[model samples]
Target chain A: MRHLVITIGCEYGAKGNAIGRKIAEDLNIKFYNRDLVDEIIEEVGIPKEIMEKVEEGGTIAGKGAEGDVRGSFSKYADLTDRAIHVQKQIIRKLAEKESCVIIGRSADYILKDTKDIDLLRAFIYAPDEVRIHNIMESHNLSEKDAKILLLEKDKRYHKRHLALTGSNRGDRHNRDILMNSSYLGIEGTAEYLEELIRRKFGSEEE
Target chain B: MRHLVITIGCEYGAKGNAIGRKIAEDLNIKFYNRDLVDEIIEEVGIPKEIMEKVEEGGTIAGKGAEGDVRGSFSKYADLTDRAIHVQKQIIRKLAEKESCVIIGRSADYILKDTKDIDLLRAFIYAPDEVRIHNIMESHNLSEKDAKILLLEKDKRYHKRHLALTGSNRGDRHNRDILMNSSYLGIEGTAEYLEELIRRKFGSEEE
Candidate 1:
């Protein structure tokens, strides 16, 4: 059987990680989230703090140190780019090895050019109102704050992802399944995706 | 309270009609499918046969009369376009008065420009496998036939809709929700959309 890899890109507050984790559990395959990628990056000697900060919407501008920080800006940008490149390399290597579910880090685009493996790309998203409600409850945030945070984070992630992948997150052509998880619930969404993946490759499974 | 309308564009065999019917029933509003449009077209002096044939994919050419009937193609096309325009006018008038769920007929794009009405555009689609299964069971068709019919019908609808609306059905920006109802039974899908609509305009309801 060919190696089957599922790549899931999600909108912020869409419970994408929860859905991806559930799919991996149901399929009995490994799942890779950002934390897993962080571990891989740390193993290569990149500071965990720098990776975490980058993950949290890039390095903060040095406090009132504007003119003094132009050099650091370029340095931070290069480190972030390097981090993304290494993550993509890790994603490609993982897909070549076995069946797994990968969440984010543009795994879909990284594997877009692969020919030998079975790749299923999905993007999970939700309406803004539902997303805001989820974020507000999960983070103990007010509705206004939740809305602002979700938008800001999504913008940053989208720009970074576009820069790295040369593709948009929710482009339908690149996806086998583009769905709103807001209505499907986490388990329902995961189970449906499992069925789709199984149906796509089940004939070849031993 | 502001007027609200939900426009659903769906791939063939996606059970979009069932979902839309349920939503209208739950919300106590009218549901307009092709039949409703046909009635309006017939009232305008177009033959029911032409409208029905157009609805059934623009009239298949008679087996032996292909060349003999080539001249009628433009006539049929003109009638079909007229039917669609009248349907859009009806859709706009309906939105002007009350909240309702409309299925197909490019209602999403027809109502796309209304500023006073709260329009929620959704595209309901399923993976090819699940859709084929639905079509086979519902139409008592062979799998191969079902697949062909689905593909052909979806292509036709997509082309006609694009020409009428200047928008693609599943484009994310054109839709507030793009969901797969393949796993979420019709009821689950309807209930979720109901919640979304309620959250959007419920504050102004008396």
Candidate 2:
């Protein structure tokens, strides 16, 4: 079998991207995040508006803004459904090609049935205060704006996950590892997770 | 409120002692393990033969054994009630003194009724191969003897835990952290558990 497939799911600005990037770099494997969004749009010819809505946690109506487009727009405009399908495709393709680190999009459930995929699924999160501070520092947003944005992003992600998989995004039942970035910090959490993976699947240095 | 009373339960040679020791050391708290056995012997003055049998997984009869006996006595005896009571007394005394780490002896169910006790329970375990190797190295025993010793020890511990609590020993349902020491070596497991305890207690270190 090939190397393990590590999937990280997290709220935005929870340092999921940084952790994924670090794991990919350390293991010398490919990393996918927003880059998969482009591939998805290219393959399905999804419009920019729908892509933005889906990425930001909104649904795209197929037609007439009501219920006319469920089966018409090639893959439909239900953003959550479309996102799930696109992510599944990407994960399948990645599995066929090589093992790598994938961030978000319910990859844990997506690749649940695949073989030789030692899926190390992790849920990354920080407290509200830590998340708000992170948003303010990274996006140069006001305190009120950061809090509002964080709350909305959290809601959307939760909604999208529920709509896609009938479960809460941060539920421990769905994850192999539930880590608080606020406690371990980004580097420490990543190193700890790396050690676990290495121990499960032999050290890379070995 | 007092500091948390942490209990770690695991099969023999599962690194529970090492993890408990590290957590106690790092938090600058007292830890009770085999020392608990000593305390029980001193307080109850149970005979050495009975103590050996009880420690090795035999139980006293419900009818004949006296609550107190001293020195060497080879006669068969029942000290189950006394043993249970003494163990509970030690746990209560420890709780009264300070927050500390207690290894085994059904501390979870013992301290289950106490308020303001942040009980961080953990189950530490490893693969059979890893555990067997550990036993050999630690006890300087041959492979065959080590395997037999490990099997008997595991059975004894399991039965003792079940006898006391009416539940399986080291079950994750009763634990806050279900850790595999096989993945994280002794030091790494301790570090991870310390991080978990800090999070559970809402320590300011974060």
> For each predicted model, how many residue pairs clash, with residues at least 3 apart or on different chains?
0, 2
lDDT of 1 by residue, A63-123 (tens): 2146546777777767776776676778888888888898887788888789878888888
Candidate 2 regions exceeding 4 Å error are: A37-41, A51-83, B1-99, B102-206
The single-chain TM-score for chain B of candidate 1 is 0.80
For all predicted structures, in order, the TM-scores are: 0.56, 0.54
lDDT for position A118 in model 1: 81
TM-score of chain A of 1: 0.82
Indicate the TM-score of model 1.
Answer: 0.56
DockQ of each: 0.09, 0.07
Candidate 1, residue B193: CA error in Å? 17
All-Cα superposition RMSD per candidate: 11.7, 11.8
The 10-residue segment of model 1 chain B with minimum total lDDT is B56-65
- Tens-digit lDDT string for candidate 2 (A1-206): 56678888887777888988888888888788866745665577656565556654434442425666546654554445665566568677775567788888777777767776666777677667778888999999999999999988888888767656677676544565556576567776777678768756777532
lDDT per residue (tens digit) for residues B1-206 in model 1: 57768888888888888999998887777787767756766787767875555544423333224654656765656666776667677778877878878888777777767888777788788767888999999999999999899988878876666656666656665565666775366787777667667655563542
The iRMS of model 2 comes to 6.4
Worst 10 residues of 2 chain A by lDDT: A55-64
